[model samples]
Target: MRETIQKVGGRLAGMVIPNIGAFIAWGLITALVIPPGWLAELGIIGAETADTLTGNLVGPMLKYLLPVLIAYTGGKMVHGHRGGVLGAIAVFGVIGGAAFELSSGAAGDPPQFLGAMVIGPLAGWVMKQIDDFLEPRTPAGFEMLYNNFSQGFAGLGLTFVGYWVIGPVMSAVATAFGNMVEGITDAGLLPLADIPIEVGKVLFLNNAINHGVLTPLGTAEVAEAGKSIYFMLESNPGPGLGLLLAYWFAGSGLAKLSAPGAAIVHFFGGIHEVYFPYVLMNPVMIVAMWAGGISADIVFVATDAGLVGPPAPGSIFAYLPLLPSGGGAAGVLIGIAVGAAASFFVGSILLRMFPVKDMKDTDADADIGDALEHIPGISTV
Candidate 1:
């Protein structure tokens, strides 16, 4: 069951990972162009310029460009170029249907990422199956006609299916998920979400959860509110930083020697995966991670902290540009600090109680690299 989940999660991660650049571009633009965004807040751009960019770039990119790119990538994953084309075609129907549904009085205008994830692969698979059946039966002289017409017909039918079926279904799913998050937030239980998130990061499902799940949900929240706590939920670098600091101060041998560099990368660079090996070497350290994540999240909720866009690398630098205007910056920094401190404190205790005995440098490095390679779209030099 674990293997099955990982495989599915890996595929989903694959679809999103390739398009991270697009996500980052959109994020950067949103951060700079929205009212009171960095540019306007800093007096670099006037309100008129900010408003113009928001309408021309931010709104359209979030609503159209991102989802289409996701669908195209997902379709390509299933059945190559042909599948990708159909997937792109089908996603438009989902986008249109969703727009129509939301215009009727829905409170928020959520992106159709969920619909794209579903229909892109579905359209691709359907196209592949059609090609498989038709290829064997086609006569030698009319291959082009058969290939072209079959895909055209399939795309047409799939677009309708996307509009009438998948779009509404996925929209409902997104809304349900959104409501669940809101309920958790309302009850002040948002910190509890860190448990699964911290565990998943250790298991190499970090990208799947952050990019595939949290990002879409966060984007929806951003549509309603200027910023979203959902964006900070999984991407916060504090817990990982705390864990590495513990290893640096409390660990022995290579683990100790390596901890400083790892901490630097994990915290400032925002590549949280660097610390996973430390936790895996001593699973007890996960308790520390949970403690840190939960502590920081509590502070986040209390302060009403959020980011205007998803921080792609989960780094401190990536976060700076997205900080909401006003007093949100203080809350964001405090939460990160709290998380790091808590994790470090707990992680130190865990290391003292259960030390990672020294292993050969090559063995430790290989083990870490091998573990990382199991995650989708990651490879170590």
Candidate 2:
């Protein structure tokens, strides 16, 4: 079972290699060059001067095109037209759904219709199958279309379709997910993210020591911002959001070690001491992290709250200032408190629900059914 699942997972990851590559390219561009220049070009921002800088075209081009292009090309490489065309449509639906929410007041359309979005891939699939009648003798009824790069043209065409026909179909689906997170986190998610900090400052030696002290001192290089793997994975407040919340508010397994560990790692360290392996010794920790991370991310983004401090290693030291500064000196501390409580609330619930073994019993059964059974969460989408 493990062997079979690995094979399938590998194949799924293989399909979205283009997007992964694009992300790497994006990192390099952001590090070596400028960051926001590209986003402004695609109307993702209102920066009128974006054309002169890398911000205008680079970010927008990649953001809009890269994802679908990756989906279509990857789908084509592995699963042929139906997979390529339809998969590309699906990718647009997810990202576009997010963007649509961000950008409202267009064509007099409502924001959250699921069927509007689902129809893009449906139409693309229909176009793909139509070949059966059009050219049954040839591959999918047409050699030229298949032989040529159908991924882009087909995907681009489907993108147009997604705008008109598909977005409405999937609006409900996207809205439901959004509403679900809003319902779950309330204001508690903010405080939960604070736990990792306390753990790191006391126990882990902290990010100040790691990112500021050790990383800079050790390396001759400047350690470009937002591009490094250290920045990419461990940069966000995602990892420890749950456990800290659990420790502080609900006191789920509220030992000194657990809460303090979350504090030291999350607060001062910004380290991903994802005690999953340890927690997975039982099982529920697996579910806890997944549900916890998702809620935390959604809440942080939705609330418009973010870390203003340097996220080099992503500790409370860096993340604190971005929160609403009401008490002047205690602003960061206040935000941390809110984030920590929320995380604990969500984490405790999830941990109790989805326990898994630390050993290799195979997450394929558990992880696969998430959306696509085989592909990776990061690589594919």
**What CA root-mean-square deviation does each model show from the true structure?**
8.4, 13.8
Question: lDDT per residue, candidate 1, 1-381, as tens digits?
Answer: 533433444455455545645665776676566765668888999999999999999889877897898789778877989999999999988887753222213344456766777788888899899989989999999999997899899889988998888877765654444444445544667798787777767654454455545677678888998888888888999889989999989997656766787687667666675676677666778899999999999999899899998875677877888899966888999999999999999999988987765433344233333333444544343
RMSD (CA, Å), candidate 2 to true, equals: 13.8
Best by TM-score: 1
Candidate 2 per-residue lDDT over residues 134-233, each given as its tens digit: 4555555567766354544555666666655555444433333323322333345533332332322222213222332223322322232211111211
Question: What is the C-alpha local distance difference test score of candidate 1?
Answer: 0.74
> Candidate 1 at residue 91, lDDT?
92
Off by more than 4 A, model 1: 99-106, 188-190, 193-293, 300-331, 340-381
* Reference-based TM-score, model 2: 0.40
Tell how far residue 317 is off in model 2, in angstroms: 13
